[model samples]
Target: MRISIIDTSSLGDRSYLIDDGGVAVVVDPQRDIDRVLALAAERDATITHVLETHIHNDYVTGGLELSRLVDAEYVVPAGDDVAYDRLPARDGYVIEAGPMRFEVLHTPGHTHHHVSYVLRHDTQTAVFTGGSMLHGTTGRTDLIGADDTETLTHAQFHSVRRLAGELPDDTEVYPTHGFGSFCSATPASGDTSTIGEQRHTNPALTSDEEAYVENLLAALSAYPAYYAHMGVINAAGPAPVDLTMPATVDPDELRRRIDTGEWVVDLRSRTAFAAGHLAGTLGFELSGSFVTYLGWLYQWGAPLTLIADDPKQIVEARRELVRIGVDEVRGAATGAIDDMSAGSALRTYRVTDFTQLSSGIPSDATVLDVRQDSEYAESHVPGAVNIPLHELLARAEEVPAGEVWVHCGSGYRASIAASILDARNRTVVLIDDAFTNAVELGLAA
Candidate 1:
């Protein structure tokens, strides 16, 4: 038996390709199925099953499309109301692929119909616990709804304990979420762990059940805004990924697109963006957490034109964007500010350090904390209003008039927020310094 772990580092999602004697099964694949297909081809294996542990809320899955591409059985959980035709998988059902046998265990906590698959061949066994259990923690239970938060947490506790109790201690465990994914309650310690190790170290297993639920609920962090659209898109079945590069548009076309109220995302370094960028273009640095922030800020399915430094950058950016279901990449514009500006105007914003703000904040300026709610709650400048960077586009009007001074955990998010404010013609000052220096800088927290 051979298992291939395909990791999408940008989203921290993992898809598994398990092959036994030239027959393979893919689990929880991302939108891009090429890698999985290529791996199967390299192994000289024919894919016989495509399994979805649940309807994903973080990224669109390629299971349906992959199944059609390979002529494999698309197996989905029994209770999900997915529109596509699939083999409804039930609890305790066993599936066979070549020399392997997979037993389905209904684990309903991350979602109403989540299930884990236990693959067995001879004396070796491996469990694929989609979002139910992690290496050091369990999946967050609040994504579905607030009403189901407590109930799901309770279910998660029992589900986790059941897996730990029922599975042999030596069984290898694999989970889709938990590797730096927001879907996890906390970051996982590593990619793989044994049932015995998890039973001893996992928080969900070690803590008291009631206390675990309370802590899990309390520790739940704010997920990306694009998450709201993922489940709906997944349930309805997303179109196959088009890996074609977005068309390259000239300056006039870019101007026309921006003039018509389309998103012109500048995927350059924050320093380059702060120096000079096209007016009305939103600066999202391509170097740091590009996909997370872009998905957070962009309107789902909206026509978007990317501005990159080169063809390579555009290709990388589009790959990241499509994984989150941002498929309407109209085209790309690549060049210096002079080349892309045409006759249009260029804009710049002022960046300041935390020490300068500590000395004195302008009386007319409103300090905006653009970090997530949890980050702001942990420590923030006194009198700073908390409006996460993701929500700023829709809630910009709520920010009072005057200059807007923005700061985040570091300078990255603050720069993005400052660019948004600059595009709106608001006088903006970016606090570009390490957030860890806030206390030493004598800023009120």
Candidate 2:
């Protein structure tokens, strides 16, 4: 059987087109379904099945749409926890595609509905291992369905060992997500791997249970607040939307336009953005919900240009816009950071503790807390005002002006909040806390 691995780089999600003669099946498809259809047509294969490993939390799954287009069966592992139309998958069920056999393995840990399908050929075997097992890690069991992380962690252990032990020694492994994704702790480097390679070198397999769990939590990056809602979108899926590329602008013209009214977005890494970023631009770092934040900044669909230090980074920024449904791009600022800095107003501040903040909070300064209402009600900076990070744009009027000390649970939300205030033409400092560190420091002017 011939197969093609489709990589949608934005979400680090992959889909497979498994072709056995003129019949094919797609697994874990991302939003752009046209690509899959075109590929199938090119191979002169009829796509008859769309197999979902689970209801993903990072991006919309295109299984529903692809099935609609091809009149194919949309199949997923059988489970009562969630609702899905089409075919339900169960353990030991074998599907035949001419000469190829798809052997189902009910491996649930990353999620309860998750499944791993082993493609058994005449001589070679490959496993479409979604979140059940990855090259460097296993799935994150702490997501919605797997409530008790501790228990789920142990369950994941057995599931990994089962796959490693039972699968053919030469079986190749292909996964759905990658390193930056939240599904697996350390998503595999390449789109595919072999069971033997992962069994020997995968960190999660090598470490003991205690060490493994501790490392998983430590490596867990801050997922978007919107990730919790992604299950709904993935279940039903989205109709294919026309995605537009940003219009290119002359470097000088772009600068003049931004100065007049356009916004600047620095679509770089979080570490790159934290070190230094454009004044008044959101510091979200081109992750999921990046366009959500852009909407927060410019709901008017205001024309904006990008300021990616790396020339190729403009493409990355544009991908984020299309993912979240933001389409306004005036152009990208070209040339060196120094050239971009010229004739442009620059805003800069350092992250401060409550002690340092105490010296800055006064008539000219104000403190703003960006945690959710419940977090704020439980404990927050004394006298500090509330404006949950997500709702900042709509409630901008409620925010008091002047030099501001903004903060959230950690510093990520605070940085995002600070950008909001910065765009509103306010000078702000970030207080690295979810508590009254802002209040104690009196950073809000």
Best by lDDT: 1
- Local distance difference test values of all predictions, in order: 0.89, 0.70
lDDT of 2 by residue, 57-109 (tens): 76667777788888998887787244447777888888776677888888877
Q: Model 2 Cα displacement at 315 (Å)?
A: 11
How close to the true structure is residue 324 of candidate 2, measured as C-alpha lDDT?
Answer: 41
TM-scores for candidates 1 onward, in order: 0.94, 0.64
Which segments of model 2 are wrong by more than 4 Å? 80-84, 190-192, 236-418, 428-445
TM-score of 1: 0.94
